[model samples]
Target: MSRRLVPLALTLALGLAPVVAVTTGATAGQAERRAAPSRTVDLPDGWQPEGVTTGRRGKVYSGSLADGSILRLNPRTNRTVVLPDSAVGKPSVGLDYDKRRRILWVAGGPEGEIRAVRLGTGEVLRTYTLPAAANDRFVNDLVVTSGAVYATDSANQELGVVELPAGLTLPPSGAATLLPLTGELVYQDGFNANGIVESNRGNWLVLVQSNTGRLFRVNAATGRTLQIDLDGRRVRNGDGLEAKGDLLYVVRNANNRIDVYDLKRNVRSGDRVKVIRTPDFDTPTTATVVRRSLWVANARFGVDDPETASYWLTRVDR
Candidate 1:
């Protein structure tokens, strides 16, 4: 793969701020005394993990593609614990943490189901099945907002939304609504909407097309989309997304790198400010930001003997 450096003048013209280092309150002497956390953490063999998210008290979570099992890892201590009562035959694609309810919303790939699992205990509170026709349905990724949880169906140009009531309780089964995607985005042969996130203070949703590497900004209420301009650059093989304020991280699985973009206030456009590449990455599919560091999961797609292959998470400093 070729690496092109964007000119500083052009980046500024595109409304992107230059990357700067964040300062800690500790002095240089004290900072040197404290040891940094490990950059890599191992997962169980044949885990085949994809989605990743962070919870309270520095807890990191990921789900297995092989068996749909959920695992919690403590990066500081390098400890891991698999949550019990997970669906064995299904696959867990994407995950989001609900702070208010202390639940983890899991995106069931191919099964077209959404599960709300209680934290620590892994007790499945509810399983909401999404409506699908004769065509295949893939619940690729999801994002949880204040009002609802929106999931992307990669095989179709629509989103599965599960509305949360005022009490923030889970609804009954088979209650997920399919919101058809309109406007600029068109479904292609392969995966369409892979990863999703909310931007511009929950007014707009950002989705990434895996095959085309294009980004779209969708209206939260209407589901109308508009293509985001990236100055003629494309994030080919984009798999997962992580957003912090105005900055967006696009994980390019095939490229083994993460593209960092500075999204504008309207969420319709952005500029790539940085590219993160590390030796620890091996087809990373998704990531979550924890304590100013990115914890990325290696899916290791197309590997021989996947049932016995090794998997791990790489920590990249932001």
Candidate 2:
């Protein structure tokens, strides 16, 4: 998270020294070699990306902390565009797209709001404001579900959930409800909840606590939660989370690494399979799987010159 919450959007200002790398799963024996699965793409230095997601045909999108905008990055063509919005300065911390409905749901920080926009057209259809609470609200990350949408409030202990009506897209008047996280999810210091994802089974919700680096499984229907065991190792500095099949990716920003996990079918626990590191990472925040690669948004929260600091996304092949 940022000074906006404590700071704004993301506060991963660890500013670790740069560690660049170059790796390809190749050897010089054969004339023909396997395609390399890792690379890096540079963004405008000040984009200050905290979230990343993918749409059809490997299209990648990142939300901005600098201007609260969304940039569509085309890896194949090396192009980027800021989506059209009536208000250009609203912060979008985390977002997910509903491909079936062509809806992009975004988390609005501090203001405690969620916006639903038409993906291709960049038209904001509805904005749902969650219930006001006494505690400060930092609407951090979110996942769009089959029947509803779930958003994590890092400044608070509960989840802001917006239930969708029978329609495929967000209803014009949908209201957001706060799902108080109970059971094993006892709130502690530092930004609590950050990245979130729906399990492959779609029966449970998976979340990462940024401060404690603990994973928790929540029953979608009940507010019940269970701490996901990770062999007693914490995923410290966890920011955004993304899951594909049995694979779960946890972006640990300050550590400048994405911790990969092989998940059990139940989604209650997982094993850290590998740690993906790229030289391009400058406190990378979140990532999305596109085809055979994972695209990460580098927030670069530590750079002194956010106005001039160059930002980029690391592409790691599967």
Candidate 3:
């Protein structure tokens, strides 16, 4: 299949899926609505954009897997600015903003380290060595809040939390703890525990287990876990997660769909899911919300396209 056609097909597939029941624990008014495309940005050739973030400057920033490069795309102009030496060979996934420090934090793949870069200059500011794990331990999704950084250790199928000091520097302090991975979500082929979104309410963190298509809620401060199934079936490779105020947005890669969970409404809270169509793509790895829209990183597997993997940092306005 051609790379250009994947996302379009997926978007159509999403439009056809049945709607799941929404629950009360979901974000407010998010479940009742479907997202329509607001705008689109085509990535540069030979670039697979992953780990995207929207800067306060009104540009989208994403990491490139091919060369460990970082790109800043200005949506208004459709022009891209490549950051020199931004790409790292190891997968760079999960981007979290430290507004207090004016920097962004990234998790490297499989026992790799955590890196921080200044938003203003794009300079590498700090690098923290990740604790070793028995499995590959790909540090996938991450979120920063209350001076603590919580990242998903996917290969190990757990979540790791590292505390960041107020000043922001390399080698963040505190110990790493493993968060449990369990839920009613089904296990599917081709993916594992992926994206995570920290709930704005209390110390709760919601995790999307890509392999099993499950959603888990964990207490960030205590590491306690609660498993909730999205209806009864497994969610598609739930790769991307972003929470804005009362709503949480989830991206299912295989389904090529996005689901919005309204935290406020009682009927659609924690258990229900409604599909929102996304642009055409083979695999969507991650998503971040910037301004009012969502940015998605669509990466095709190597087997799908041996010569090169066509990826996009697509912007969804809905």
Candidate 4:
């Protein structure tokens, strides 16, 4: 589901802290040498961004929920550019950059559409309309793999799959398929499958259940799932997921924090290694690691007004 529509009263009911310190043991000098200089990059007012991904040459990409426009940010130079209108007009929730094909796969929230945009020219190459009943689908996030692209439907119990042809060629429209989720994972009242990532060397896909605060390991081919044990810790309100080697980062939206987990070799279990919190986070929805730092997109849900409110990206040193 698009979190922008979640009521403000529900957010207040969570009683999340406004700030939580990120603890580290390294000396100040050592930390400064290892970490990049922390900073913020302001987005267009009312951008209402939810997703973030890093591209070649240190370029950071995010999509605006308000207009479906894609914004490109160069953190090093602090420059910004808005992509063409070919992919605009639909809410863009999550996106991934395809290095092999130089395409940016964007999830069309509530529209049940996935668009492939050329990274260099901003031309929308193709828009695939996922098969689902009207008003019953919310294409939340997507992850690209070697042979296919998998997307989550926050409002349903199935995943939208787009199989790429040989040579990583984009498939024709109406070629997408649906993979029904089975096993321990269940769809609840609110958002169910929100974020997805491939782990265990691409043998397993890890998914976060937003409403239940549970992580599940899914068989990519069979769609069978098993709940991941998180050492009794729950990542409630988890929105976007990022996996780096054996480490997984879960962005807990309402809590204003990101939880890092150390996953086991089989990806069936994990231990919470750290909690990343900052005052700058205003309902951060997703993140991408760049040069030892995490660039987070603040969705700022529940603000008094979204159309005129300020929006920005917070760069936290990991």
Local accuracy by lDDT, each model = 0.83, 0.78, 0.64, 0.83
Please write out the lDDT profile of model 1 over residues 213-286, one tens digit for every residue: 89999987999999999999998778899999899999987667789999988887899998786667777789
The window of 10 residues in a row where model 2 has the poorest summed lDDT is 1-10
Error of 2 at 89 (Å): 0.8
Model 4 alpha-carbon miss at residue 160, Å: 0.1
Model 4: residue 25 alpha-carbon error in angstroms: 17
lDDT of 2 by residue, 1-318 (tens): 222111322343332223333245645433123333466777766777887899867799888777777878888987887777623577778979887787678888777888887677566788888887768788989998877889999877788888876777456645588888999988786688889999987689899988888999988888689998888878877889999998889998777788889888777778989877655666778999988888988887755668776677779885
Over 4 Å off, model 1: 1-38
Let me know the TM-score candidate 3 reaches against the reference structure: 0.78
Which ten contiguous residues of candidate 1 have the minimum total lDDT?
14-23
Q: Estimate, for each residue in 203-270, the C-alpha lDDT of model 4 and write its tens digit.
A: 68999998889999999899999999998888888999988889899998877788999999888899
Cα lDDT tens digits for candidate 3, 80-181: 777765655655667777767767777776535567776755566766655666665678778777767778766665567667665645454334655554
Misplaced by over 4 Å in model 3 are: 1-35, 167-191, 264-273, 303-309
- At residue 104, candidate 3 shows an lDDT of 77
Score residue 201 of candidate 4 by CA lDDT: 55
Give the clash count for each candidate: 0, 13, 31, 0
Q: How close is every model to the real structure, measured as TM-score? A: 0.87, 0.87, 0.78, 0.89
